[model samples]
Target: MPLSTRQSVIIALIVASAYFMENLDATVIATALPHMAATFGVTPVGLSIGMTAYLLAIAVFIPISGWVADRFGQRSVFGGAIVVFTGASVLCGLSNGLVEFTVARILQGVGGAMMVPVGRLAVLRSTEKHHLMRSIAYITWPGLAAPVVGPALGGFISTYFSWRWIFLLNVPIGLLGLALTATFIPNYRASTHRPFDVSGFVLSGVALICLMYGMELVGQLHSDWRITVAALTCGAGAAALAIRHLGRAAHPLIDLSPWRIPTFRVTLDGGSLYVVSVSVSPFLLPLLFQLGFGLNSFAAGLLVLAYAAGNLGMKSVTTPILKRFGYRNVMIVNGLLTAATIAMCSLISPSTPRVLITLVLLIGGLCRSMQFTGINTLAFADVPPARMSSASTFFSMVQQMTIGLGIAFGAIALHAAVLVHGNHAQLSLADFRVAFLLVAVLVLISVLYFIGIEPDAGREVSGHTRTASR
Candidate 1:
């Protein structure tokens, strides 16, 4: 039987809660990493493996999420995912060694890999076309909160309580979500005619894993040349294999034809560059605070709160700005603004006032929000309804991959700065200044991708409003 309106609302809330928790887990470890390292007796690089393991697991399993959701029902996959994720979180907290924690993180990643895409798919399939965007907007609000709230929350728990509490917090929320899903979420099965596309799946997974691993290795540039060369070769070869598989498959996992769309291509190019540049800050800022400026975890967490404030503050106005100026203009101008704000971070120093640093981060966060809003909206604006599912999957995959790469690149930049300045033990105020400047330059270069977009291109603001109203 079809669900009632009340049931649907409950289901949406359940999924949103799960979604928020899943994403929150991804970054909650950042502020707690120092403590986790101390507890595990590992170096920064070794502790970073916790993040790497999670990301690699997610990337490897993402391609199969859609298939699993189709083979089983959405409710089954989503509910089961919540249980697995929650259980894994408990194990992660209980872990006594680095290897054990890494294994638990991978298991958590496996559950997360299923939770998001399937939940989104359920919401999409359940809602009417007119109500679709609104439903998605509601579901996505929790996700926006994750980045804003995660650092502060994680820091408070890790500092006041224990790092274990960070993972333990997921338990109650997951249980509630699971109960809601079991009660309200409907089962959805795949069409019999749709083939699994095994070859495409394998090749695509290999390609993504290699590329992400290669990017991670790039951070260890001082490592053995043989290791670097091997990773690069594997990444390149896997990419070639995926491309070949895409050409031959009857039903390719990702339809590369979308790249042929000029607007789609431009949006992706601009978005990727923008994410790579902006995504690095979250990972870099905490380390800088502790090592460079000698701030405590609580204080550093507050600075991150400022970034979230700017992001949330801009949410209301960002869409309107895109509508008024159109995607091309908004992206081009805002992209520059984002880069300039990040570059301004270079001015940060131990001698710099806290108020000034916070103000700079606030501006950067606002611009980052605008840039992401514009790019994401424009990327999908031209996609036909028939291709929406594939487009969404592809977009999500790229977003995740880029975020991982961004952090890796930031690590590389910081490591290089430390090497150049001959400061090995602790990062200095000067090291952060140089690293921020380098990332800011990279952000500036991203503006070139948006240059391809015409001012008149993309749906107009009035049109979107009219459609929404109807």
Candidate 2:
């Protein structure tokens, strides 16, 4: 029997909460870094290991998440992951040394790698086609809001309380997530499981690890460019090998068949490119405000609140908008608007009115919310039920990679601007202008991919009525 509407909504919310917890944890640590370094008796730069460790862990483990869930059961793996993550959070809070903290973060990543993809798989298996958009909307906001909100929230908690509270805060949320997962989540497994693809796993894992580590290197303000290039090159080579191997393997670690589906292919290609462009904002905005606009970190963080408001503002109306406009029209139009807003950031100067900046961010947030929800929901609109596991896993992996790429893209753009102008010790307003324009261009490139989408594609889920051709 299909899950009732009420049950479906409940499961979606529970999964959303778990996603929120994971995202918040990932970003919340930034503001608390200084305090953490003080406690650990190390430089702030040294603590980057903790952040990189978590990311690398997630990248290495995500490819196998689907296989593990199928080998076990979704509910069993999901609940166990929660336990592991929660326990690791406690360990993070208690750590007095960098090694201990980094290890704890890796453990947390392992749990998170399994938690989200499997939970999403369960949701897709249970939700009716009509409900997919709303279900995706429910889950999308937390990921969007967490990055915007995390810095301010972390600053507040770190200033008034101990930095340890940052990790410890996850305790209650994780505990509640555990209860919900065990009670409501179904234990799904493959009826006929394939043997593990050990070779495929090795190739994919190396590719992701190198790619992520390379991006991490690029994002750092002071890193060896030589090492970054080498890491990225190795990642690309390994990725090519992984793709070739998966195509030939009898029981591939990740099923590449989803790429043959038009809707799913669009999401993997166009949607990922869009993500790379959009991801640049979070990395760039704070630097723009602090370095370019002469604003304090607090004021800069406050400005992002407008963006977050726009995200929440659109949440209630996304379903209606999609139903009215359909995915193809909505994504192409909204994506352009999103790029326009991003480009507008280049116009902000010290003298630019804060209100105008706020308005721009608000509009950008709205467009981002709609475009992301549409792309995500539509990816699965045409996927078969049996392929949900592999589809979700592949999508999750791409999402993670693109996010890392976004940050790297922003950092590299800023670096290039610096080189183009006379090399300076500190970045200037003109540097930001160049960077924003470049990021905007990245977004525009994605539109070419979006243009390939079929006119009536994803109409089934969006509920958009197609008019007959005259």
Q: TM-score, each model? A: 0.85, 0.98
Candidate 2 per-residue lDDT, tens place, 265-334, comes to 9988999999998888888898899888888777888998888888888999998888877778888898
**lDDT of candidate 2 at residue 20, scale 0 to 100:** 88
The digit string of per-residue lDDT tens for model 1 on 1-470 reads 22555666666677778878988998788778888889999875679888878878888777767667767877899889999999999999998899999999999999988887778767655654333333454555555557657877887888899999899989999888888888778887765435778887787777777778777777664566677668768878987998888777777776667777777788788779888888888878877777777888678878877887777677667655655666666777888888788777777777888899899888887887777666655665566645555665667677778887887789788888988999888778787878888898887778888887876666532134323322
Best by TM-score, which number? 2
lDDT of 1: 0.76
Residue 188: error of model 2 in Å? 1.4
Model 1 regions more than 4 Å off:
1-16, 33-47, 97-99, 123-152, 182-189, 220-225, 415-427, 454-470
Deviation (Å) of 273 in candidate 2 = 0.9
